[model samples]
Target: MIIINVLDNFQAALEAPRVLSLNSSKYFSGPYGEDIVFIANDWHTALLPCYLKSIYKSRGIYKNAKVAFCIHNIAYQGRHAFADFDLLNLPDEFRSSFDFIDGYTKPVKGRKINWMKAGILESDRVFTVSPHYAEELVSGEDRGVELDNIIRSTGITGIVNGMDNREWSPQTDRYIDVHYDATTVTEAKSLLKEALQAEVGLPVDRSIPLIGFIGRLEEQKGSDILVEAIVKFIDEDVQIIVLGTGKKIMEKQIEELEVTYPGKAIGVAKFNGPLAHKIIAGADFIVIPSRFEPCGLVQLHAMPYGTVPIVSSTGGLVDTVKEGYTGFHAGAFNVECETVDPDDVDKLATTVKRAIKTYGTQAMKEIIQNCMAQDFSWKGPAKLWEKALLSLEVAGNEPGIDGEEIAPLAKENVATP
Candidate 1:
């Protein structure tokens, strides 16, 4: 039903540019359906490329349009029973596009319809979030989630995602109580730290190293290992703050931290956008121990605020962080294991202790300046996206349809359908 709804709305969007205005003597003055390039992101919209190829293009409408499929995370590919293929309402000839036979030892055996596979097969271009993640997906079955071969054959590109510097910037963020750039970071962060400590019910001390963990508390985000690492530091002077909600077990564990080690730890198991800004602004270090990250945004958010990240070296975490310079590597997690490794917990705790040792040193100040100076804005990534999209133009066709110069469409022109 979602596929059908998306297809119907897509067809409507295709016809929108041709709609005649009843008040004026002109139609919508923009590129028509044939000039558009659709981008389908992840599994929810993965079927768009397949439908465009097998339905719209087959009917001679949107003949020149192309689809680029973006894989944010390959783990959650839309898989359903082969019998449910009929719900798609596609022709019998396209059935082969959705067919899959699982050969792995995992459960859910026999044939299934994999939407992400079809998207990769049908789309003109395929890409993931970060270059490292792109390589990880194609490296082996461990990171690929059973789609590595298809990803390798399709040839994935990686464009690291960008952060909204305006919103996340320390100098201009409206959410934060105080503002600071590299020059004033020390004094400003001290003030913000005191304020945040008071707000979260922790002891208001600016001298102690205040560490933060902000993300979904799940296995992927390494919440279990974070808890274990906190246990190792229960007797230490460092203070830790965690912001996010996930599995009830993880939430309970986080809440337990405050009770187990009063004045040293606090966890808020709910989403609070304003507090998030305050935490990033106030904390000395941000922890992102993701087991497998696909171009994490939290680390990017931390960098501009001079909050050094202590992250697991996997996927985009490896791409963005420079050890001992911008942040510390908490060591990589075992990708093949179903549960957290004790060694990973020890590594994270050791790294946190190392960071605490470096807290007020001259070297730590230099690291803060380096972190603040690093740029993760969208300007560079946007150009790469434009170049990638332009390369998808059909060989024989001119850049524009019917001699009209093909101006880049604004965000409003891109249809979510």
Candidate 2:
């Protein structure tokens, strides 16, 4: 076993993995026998062909190597022009699967191939971060982009991600001004909320239900929806504190709201980890109204803080947050029936209003306790991953070098390159 590190000073190319794929993978891939090559997310998966060709050229077709692809998000697929294929050093056979084609046309209009698609097809085993997200990627209306048919033909396994409890615990987190546990959460919340309000220049009133938004200011994170519903949120006497940055338009809108409704809405358009931790601790409820969340760690981070999450029922958020139990689920999708529509402002307003009304009540206290009580440690999820990997290893080595059982999967969607 050998590990080689390739370092490039070009930052721009690194951001666009497609540009760096060939060079990076050429350095990373090597000839090996009975080995597993695990690729992570779209960034590294863009180099699938490069890695495969390198390994196969040196080790031959029956080298007994299996590739595992782990998908964090189906969005943000690394797409590049067909011209760039020349640089990949791959055999002429990989063109069709790696080249993008428009699925809209009957004849299939050729566009740019999505690198994520290539990785999924090339992978011996596909794993997503959460079970619900895995199902959503394959079966639902909001399935993975241009790869659902292939995913259904093949199969994907989902494992719910576990949170790092030691780093995220409110009781022990050094980021927060106050240390708190489930028993001390209420009093700590009150003090921190007041302090946070003063710091952000919002009203330091303990009665107002302060909801926190700590993520990217993008459509997926529902930043636009939150901005749109600001008047309504203000109407309900709910104060909002947002900490993160993204789209300029959304940031402008948030900034405008802060100006429009002084002491009600505050947007800090920057990435500050300490502030994020403080927001999770101080805010009564953390809001995660993402359009499609694969496995959101924000809600997990919030749970242990006794900070209830108001989430859109999708992906890992749906799996983690129990409706009306530990947290509130805004009806972005019907969890039971698997239907989706644009989130309604009125519905979100109602949900926030309900949370505001229930704030500080015995019921809310119980819910907070439940949120804190729930376990999301890595122990179980790690074991599940280990078992899956072991099974794949066993399956791959069954027929020795003649490995026709697993070899058939390689021919899945590849056109004659």
Candidate 3:
């Protein structure tokens, strides 16, 4: 049987075999020679998942059991895409731990994916965070490689994400004024709404509905379309509260809108988790205007707070947020629409207006109730991994597997890149 380890270092999955860190295999294609799979996410900060999956395959690790990961943003190739952070200013505790790679600049290339590809190919399985994304990465070829073929050789799983209790709990929250849980959903909602409005300097008029738009302000995040839509809708009864900073033009427009529609539009150019949670609790609806979401955590945060979501139908949003249940679908194919443009100003505004109307119905209430009841925990997913590891068939390496029989995977035997 093959044993697997799940590293909690956020980028442990992305840095499978350590992409940013220098490696013996960085310049060479692998015949990895050992079995070890790393479950990586965070594509923006590291290599595309399959490259590493393939890296493991080439190494002959998968001859016994394939190595895999839960990938997010697997195919995103946008400009200035990598996360920009002060790596040098990392905390004293973190600094001492990562002394090996002080000048890490970039990850391995996707086209030269053999090293990563070999790992995945040799692996017993590869699990993705979103079923749709698993289907996407496993279906098409982009530049030089065929993603479909790469995925075919490895078993890909679509494991939906669960929130960390340490971070998302409302019981001991420091951000919200009131701390409550699923049982006190009603009281929590009301309190959060009032507190959020007051914090944002908006009126506490119980009659008006507030719309919460939070997250990074980028096209994938759906802020560009939202700016255009809000311009057209421009309603007095509906207030829009936005948290995050991106796109200078969008920020300026949001600022202008707040002035133009005093007490209606509030924009915060920063990420405050407690504030974000309160905003979710207080709002009538939450909008996850993502173009391609691979299991969004925000949609998860909103449902339990009784805030309906207005999202595009894609990735985890499809699995988690129901079309007409926990939230309404914006239904615009913002991406890959060559013939008909995704929603223009008029259509975007119309959709928001329609969703707002439906949000007030008893039917909407039932949908939220259903969403809250669903399980969003890691216990179930951990069990699935346990089963795969337990049942995995193995053998020692042979000439067929590169030389001697492929050895059964043990934690001590799993090698690094």
Candidate 4:
């Protein structure tokens, strides 16, 4: 009900300018949403585009406005009972837009309404976080979550997300104790690693290769696979630290690793921002074995800190992590389902071993230098976004705007919910 009311207020605001009066002395006027480009993110605000086309546009309101739908993750689509569609108070003609039938089930469940499907069909443009993720979404039903056909027809754009260099940089990070750039990373990391080992109750040894894992302990994050892989190196010269909070089973599995191998591993099943920074700064390598990543920020954060990443070669991981240059690829797995694959576990273990072999060598230093030298900041990605948004303004035109584009106008009018 609140969402519906908010949408109604949004439409009203767009339909006419609002006047603000100060005690008979001053007045302010809000813009009547002209040439505005609305950006609806995920399922929560999916109905905004539909309302614009069906109600407002039919009555000649916000006619020049365009809406772009951004899909951060396709797994959740705001599925609800078909009968609940009445609560939206939409026209009967728009019912088909939200209608969805789940054919994968054995008993063939009753009809449901999907908000994301409607947004995809109605929006002017569709976007995902990364290029590889965009391709994967249109490739098949497995990654697309049963919306591949619609996504393919609509044509989605992909732009890799960027990190805030100011906050994530080793020299400027406020969370970690020690700070260093590429040149001083080796000595600084040695000190951080020892400090981290003591903080996490592990034996402080600078020679041991410290590996870190930080993210939700969910099936999507491949936490089970990580635990399985780390178990293989219990008796080895490696040290592991994991920090995250999710799924009781996964949390228990991580705790078991700490109990089983006290010195080699420690798992803190909670979110600690400072601890996360320390782990990234201190660890020689960070493992991100996600089943599917739509432009992961952790690898971007890890690289600048001289921490090599060992990741699965799927989605944004493929785009960001260069094998043997910046990080090691753990091999891409067929993401047909959420079940953990034994092969993926083996592949990750092998990649970890490979990364361990490169440790403490001049080759390792070169890789670290390469990782640090690369830029994952917002400047490049911001330009790509500018190009994408401007392309919307000139749909069929060739060689759109110059460097000084209408990016500011596009940025100013974009309303996201």
Candidate 5:
């Protein structure tokens, strides 16, 4: 349970005159146990050096520690300025290890290091959030841009991410007006649909399928494509409810769409977790037309609420949503494509229409049932992660920090650097 809060003031740390203000001296004294998990760039980039220093300090204590570096997304690999490398205070021998050059394509840049790449190179095991995404990275889909070659050689595994089932359960969720599961979800859904429509000031109609979009308003999430499709189908018999805010231009466009379609469309420009749960419980279909996704958790959260997800056929969306079974999928856009086009819109609209037509039909009910039957809970993934860690070979005779030797991490033991 120990949560190290390192450099609480990020801006202050950045503006500090000296590098030692990061307090590596105090944090490096701690001992490394049998396992260490490097999360995304924020923590991994900042704490990696401290962890490395600590490992070097406690060489006797952690001779055979296993490290796992989890890549949530490789698109935004931590690429700080070359001058900032001095802040890491790494020794001369290891300094060049972090030094990276952009040479996969044309015109090699001088001395730019990717922290994510460094983590991948350093870790005992590497993993991403989904199997398909892991494949994509190694396949050079996105130019193999960041460390695809290294990743392929080093072996990166994919373990689909899971959600907190208890928090997303439709039968137990407190955010929704009514609680129901697969068996009684139909009636509950109808009631919640009307409630949601009235709450958002839509026409309170159950016949028209209410399509909900609750993610970032960015091209990567295919917000542009979604907005285009909705605008194209403004006159169609459906309601659009957007529950997220990003990209000022897209937000403005969404608000404009809301105004143009008055009661039929509404864009609540913010991230409200409870509202998201309510939207999931109330909407007939949740749309996630991401251009690229490592492993999306929103669709997983939506499924337990008996909400059918209409996703782009890529990454975890493909792994989770079975066509016409749990839900439906549209086009699978590749990295070579500059932008999502009308063809993508056609695919999206076709599935949306299918979902609408199937409303109240036996097929729709079965689909909802199938979605609810799915187990996207974290239990399986936790076991898989544990198995991955245990598979690693221990090299030293030094005493391992198993349950018998070391106490569990507690809040009291959290070191503040």
Candidate 6:
């Protein structure tokens, strides 16, 4: 059974640089002797699309193999049970409807064990998207006891998410007005001007630096800090571009800022794929002010396009964005964010100014262009899972044991206002 867990991938990747292949087995195929297992990225909401994909893959290739999903983020809030066929994309931003449902209903936590229960019992092996995410399931805050039991019984592994080089390549991107590799800044700048301005819905002004931001509007990615930073820098000469929608407090502020900033601030609060790539390719600088980024693709995407990133030091951002090389990093800030205090905003603004200064200078831009040329596609990530899935031996056994399954409760469904 070949399974690809893409829970809510299209929406999670809505504002990502390119549209990820929803067609799972093709992206994650077993070489010859290997069979695939299934999982979802989000359990509460995006489960159905992935489930459908697994069903499709099973029918075509591994008809006899049992395919199932390792519920993604089952412990996101707490344990919650997921309803059958809750896969259709639902809008939670327009109204405050999802609120009473999330806090009171407690949906996400309900599906924790059920998701794993299904994965371990049915799948030869369970796979996650990232090593970090895998760790969470193994030894996460909520999964402490259950994770161990699952390990004693069920086998699980983390596979770093992959990117399509075809879509992300700088050598040939229609999104950028100028197509250049590491050695062609002159045309890139021209391309940056026309392509970015048009892409972001801003006027094509080569004179000003175009700034870009794309991600979920939650504290996990330092969404709160980013909101503050934007508000702080709204009066500056730079053109700001934002994508994606999440959380009421953050989303409302962004909308208000859009009204306040007008043409200077461009935002698309829906699932838009192509526009995100254009923004990433066209922008002078990309921002990933994450509070705790497990493994971020945006910063990776940002670099290839000569888009210097300004990220918070944590998780994947720290691993990918080297200071003064691909991007700049500010130190630790948690969910509560007491460490960020008032001085944090100044530092963020300073970082942006510095990155802009770096972009404006001919020598610095060349340095940035050099960094972006490096590859970060699916080849490496796919191989890790490819080996795991094809091997199918954890502790020299194929069938892993089952742990205690949690009682299904109401789950949480999230969206932006």
TM-score for candidate 6: 0.62
Q: lDDT tens string, model 3, 148-237? A: 566666657777776543344456545567776656765666777887888888888655677888877766676766766776665637
> Alpha-carbon error at 83 in model 3, in Å?
24
**How well is each residue in 274-329 modelled by candidate 6, as lDDT tens digits?**
66777777777778776555567787776777778887765556666778767787
Q: Each candidate's TM vs. the true structure?
A: 0.88, 0.80, 0.67, 0.88, 0.81, 0.62
Off by over 4 Å in 3: 1-37, 42-66, 76-124, 138-149, 152-155, 181-184, 247-249, 336-348, 389-391, 394-417
Using TM-score, rank the candidates from best to worst: 1, 4, 5, 2, 3, 6
lDDT of 1 by residue, 113-172 (tens): 888898888889998888999999998888998899998898999999876676678898
Give the TM-score (vs. native) of candidate 3.
0.67
Window of ten residues with lowest summed lDDT in model 4: 408-417
Residue pairs with backbone atoms closer than 3 Å in model 2 (clashes): 92-417, 93-417, 100-112, 100-113
Q: How many Å off is the CA of 86 in candidate 5?
A: 2.9
Please provide, for model 5 over 335-379, each residue's C-alpha lDDT reduced to its tens digit, 9 standing for 90 to 100.
433566778877777767777778778998999999999999766
Q: Name model 1 segments beyond 4 Å from true.
A: 1-6, 9-32, 103-109, 394-417
Better of 3 and 5 by TM-score: 5
- State each model's CA lDDT, in order: 0.82, 0.71, 0.57, 0.81, 0.71, 0.56
Please give the lDDT score at residue 142 for candidate 5.
68
Candidate 3 lowest-lDDT run of ten: 408-417
Scored by TM-score, the top model is: 1
Model 1 deviation from native, Cα RMSD in Å: 5.3
* Clash pairs (backbone) in predicted model 4: none
Compute the lDDT of residue 177 as modeled in candidate 3: 75
Q: Per-candidate RMSD vs. true structure?
A: 5.3, 10.2, 13.0, 5.6, 7.8, 12.1
